[model samples]
Target: MKLRRFFCLFLSVACLGGIAQAQDDAASLQEVAQRREAQLADALERLRTLRNDIEAQQIPLAQRLQDLDAQIRERQREVERRQRIRDNQSVELDTLRQRVSDRQRELDYISRTLLPEYFANYDASLSAGERATAGEDVRQYNLFLEKPDTSETDRLQHSLALLRDSWAQLESRLGGKRYAGEALDPEGRVISGRFVQTGPLLYFAADQGELAGLAEETTALNATVTPLSTSQNAHIVEVAQAGRGTLPVDPSLGNALAIEQTRDSLTEHLEKGGIWVYPILLFALAATLVAILKIFQVYRIRHPQPMAIHDIVKALRAGQRDEAMRLARSQPEPAREMLVAAVEHSDESVEMVEEVMYESMLSTQPRLERFLNVIAVTASAAPLLGLLGTVTGIIKTFRLMTVFGAGDPKPLISGISEALITTELGLVLAIPALVLHAMLSRKVAGVMARLEKASVAFLNGLSRKSLNQKAS
Candidate 1:
């Protein structure tokens, strides 16, 4: 039994020691778990701090990326805007080039064609200095056309200057003025003289009585100066010296001067009409005078006193023979003579009275017909005289042609002018003379008709009075 108790005590001691060791092991494990919990808390706090730092860093980086993206989009838009500006600028440059080319072409045409043509027909009335200047301008214009270095603006400015200068020069020349110049005389000699210009009409007169008229040239450079006739020279010289003389003005400016230079004067033309014109003029004058006298005489005879015929008839019907005779005597000659013869033979028969009145009427008819034959003879003879003159002129023309062999036409023209003038004058005289003769004849016939009517009425009155006297 003693041995069994000792083993139990030893087992109990071993159990107590094992229980204490287990308790100690549990306390160490709890302490190790607390240390691991603190380490884990520290690690988690470090992770949170790291996450906050990363988030703060991520905000700046994201803003940087957004800024980069915005910059890239701006760069693309800027490229597109620059391209559009370049396109617009290219179109504008092309338009400017085309305008420059068109302007250049216009300038070339003016230089080549227009300027040369203007110089070709330059006014002949211009002075030598003005013409020289114009010629130089034309040469310069030609040079400008040939030169390639000249700009369009420079060429256009030059052309405008040339046109302005040409116009001013023309205006200065058109206004007429007096000047000193050399003129050509009839002998083809040059004479220094004073020149007078009225528009295009120019005249030159020297101190030595050398006078000439100038003619403009259309193609040549110098004008032709023609010497005038002696009388015309005197007149022109007087006008040039006195400055107030009746010069022969050309109504058509230069045209009349040109025509007059080729034709004869009026005085020379009239002298060529021959001596027959004088005879024609005399015939016309005489015929005119005779016609006027006959017309006056017939007019007087036709229109007598209005109351004389009625008074005579009433007095005779009332048996107042003396009063009736006095009234009849106051009438025109034709009626007076017939009434006087009837009154003187009042006691005679009607047939005797009628025979006496008819004798008086025949006698008065010759007076009324006086000078009519003369007018008729003049009208008939004027044309015959003109015909004779024409025949003589033609004969003279043929004689001149025979002598000159038809080579010189001057004498032929003179003879022809004379012949034509004589015929024209004859016709002019004959036409009026014929008209006057016809009028005078009609007037004389009317007077005779009135005389016959008065005579028949007087005869009837006489017959009635005589029959009443017999019946009573």
Candidate 2:
């Protein structure tokens, strides 16, 4: 029994020991689990931290990429805009270049062609200062054209300035006015005078009447003035002093004045009137003398104051036949002669006395109408002579034309002048001669009528006296 109880005690001790070891093992296991949990918690915390760091680094990269993308887009748009701008600028540059070329061509034409012709024709009309200025401008313009170093802008500016100056000068010259200057006369005398200018025409008048005339520019460079005439000097002076007088004006500006300067004298003009002009003048003189003599004869015959028909009739009615005859014989005229013939035949029969008076009238009519026929013939012949002169002149002109080949007008001028002047003189002679002849014919008719009336009155009175004596 005691051995069995010891074995149980040992068994019980073993059990106790195992149970304590098991409890200890359980506590150890619990401690190990707690350590593993702590390790895992630490590892999870590290993973979260790493993930946050990665997200942060990736965010910056994404922002940089977005910024880069935006920059690329903006650069592309800028390139497109610059291309458009370049295209527009190219078009504008081309247009501007074309305009510049056109302007250059216009400027060249003005410089080369127009300026030279204008200067050649109108340069003489400019004043001395203006001429010098314009000449300098032209010289510079020519230099600019010839020189390669001159800039286009500078050339254009200079050309514009020259054009403005030229236009101003031309305007002033065309607008006429008076100015004071020195003038050279035809007699080689220099005179200070007031000058009147109209375009190219210029005239000068001195304070004294001795120097006044038209002037022409002899030298363009020094503006030397030369006179055209002294013939109208006094008239020009009068006009200048009075502001209104018979002053000569150049109708053809300078052309007619130049022709007048070379015109022939009066004697030369008459000489050009040809040989027919002398006959025409002689006819005119003869017609004039005949007209005068006829007028005197008609006046004496038609209206004799002492032997008037009324006075002769009164003396005959009072039986003063001798006194009547004496009054009739006092005047030496056709009417007086007719009255004397009637008085001498008053003692005859009425028919015989009428026949005697008719014979006397016929004799006086011839004398009255004698020179009038010559005047009439001259009047008719003058125009014929003028036509003959015209024909002769035309023949001469044709001859000159044939000889000279119609090249020069000077050769034809003489013949033409002769023809025209002879015609003019012939017309002058013809018109007056015709008028005088008509007047003389009318006067002769009137004188014949008056003489016939006086002779008829005498015959009637004598017939009445003869009848009264026969009745007694």
Candidate 3:
């Protein structure tokens, strides 16, 4: 029994030892499991923290990307706006170019239309009438063919005055009956005798075989139903009063022929009417064209920028001498030249600067006066030329009278009318041109004076600056 008990105890101790070892192993495993679980929890926490960080970073990155997209859209809009502006500007530029081209074409057409060729036919017609009328009147007969501007009417009127003043001169020249004495009534009745200082009073025999008185009586009798009546008398008067060659008719032409020629010439003048209007229209066109050209040139020079003296002055006062010079060189004028002079003498004495400015003014004076004398001459000559044309017309009419006996007064009257019309046209052209020339000249002088004043002031201001610097 003792042996048995001892064996059992050994077994129990072995079993207990095994159980304790197992328990210890289980405790070690449990500890290892707890540590692994804590490590996993830590890993999970780290994963969650990384996820939160990523999400936060994503929000900022997304926001940044959205901002970038908005910026890109904004840039596109800006580009579009700029493009639209450029497109609009291009369209406007094209439209302006087209308008300019059309205007140029219109101007060219107008210029061609207004040329003298178009009106030459009309002038020829008027000239024909003028040629027919100049012959009958004594005044008309005297005119020279070389100069037609002095009309038959003008000559007649002049000669009539002359004849009235000195009847002896007409009788000696014209071979007309000299009535030193005697006067007749319009009814073929003798009114009185003209007192002759040297001899018996001369009387004119009337168509009724009655003696007509001279002087007033002869004039009164001749005033009506006389072959050489009012027109003839007028012609005689004109021839007597005027310069010798200026008379349209030959005083030598019989009194009847003179009167008849005057009437015929007047009739012919009416038929040809176009001559007077065409020249006037053409001249006006030419003047207008010249004015337009001048205006165009002025507009061309004045556009984009204006030459402002005030701006130049500002530049000068600022001591920006180079800028001032550049500005002055932009235009050719008294003001620019004076400004340049002042800038050149920036350091000079005030008096010296003033003298320099004065020199500039004198230099520009001739330029201001340029073409003004020509304009004045043209103004004076236009009317004279018109008068000459009228005289020529009259001469032509008188020449016709010599060729064709005065059957009708129409041509002669027409010629006289044309001469008068030409004279009037000349005055019309000359007066306005002269006035415009004077006005333009005055304006140029005024502008030049202003330039001089401005220049003086600028120089004074510059010299003052120098003086101040010296004082300093």
Q: Report backbone clashes per prediction.
A: 0, 0, 83
> lDDT tens digits, residues 1-472, model 3?
9999999999999999999999999999999999999999999999999999999899899999999999999999999999999999999999999999998776556433432232233223211112122213332323432255966455445544533533343233344222222333555544332221112111222333333222221223122222234444443333333312112233332354446546645335433433654555466556545444433433232211233555665677677878878887774554666767877876567788788878877887776565556556657776776777687778877976877658977667666666776777678878877786766666666676566557655665566566667897
lDDT of each: 0.74, 0.75, 0.56
Could you say which candidate leads in TM-score?
2
Model 1 regions lying over 4 Å from their true place = 1-77, 124-168, 174-179, 184-190, 196-286, 300-332, 340-348, 351-431
Winning model by lDDT: 2
lDDT of 1 at 279: 84
Please provide TM-scores, in order, for all candidate models, with all chains considered together.
Answer: 0.56, 0.58, 0.35
Evaluate model 2: give its lDDT.
0.75
Clashing pairs in 1: none
Off by over 4 Å in 3: 1-320, 323-334, 402-407
Question: What tens digits encode model 2's per-residue C-alpha lDDT throughout 31-62?
Answer: 99999999999999999999999898998999
Residue 213 local lDDT, model 3: 24
Q: Indicate the worst ten consecutive residues by lDDT in candidate 2.
A: 219-228
Q: Rank the candidates by lDDT, best first.
A: 2, 1, 3
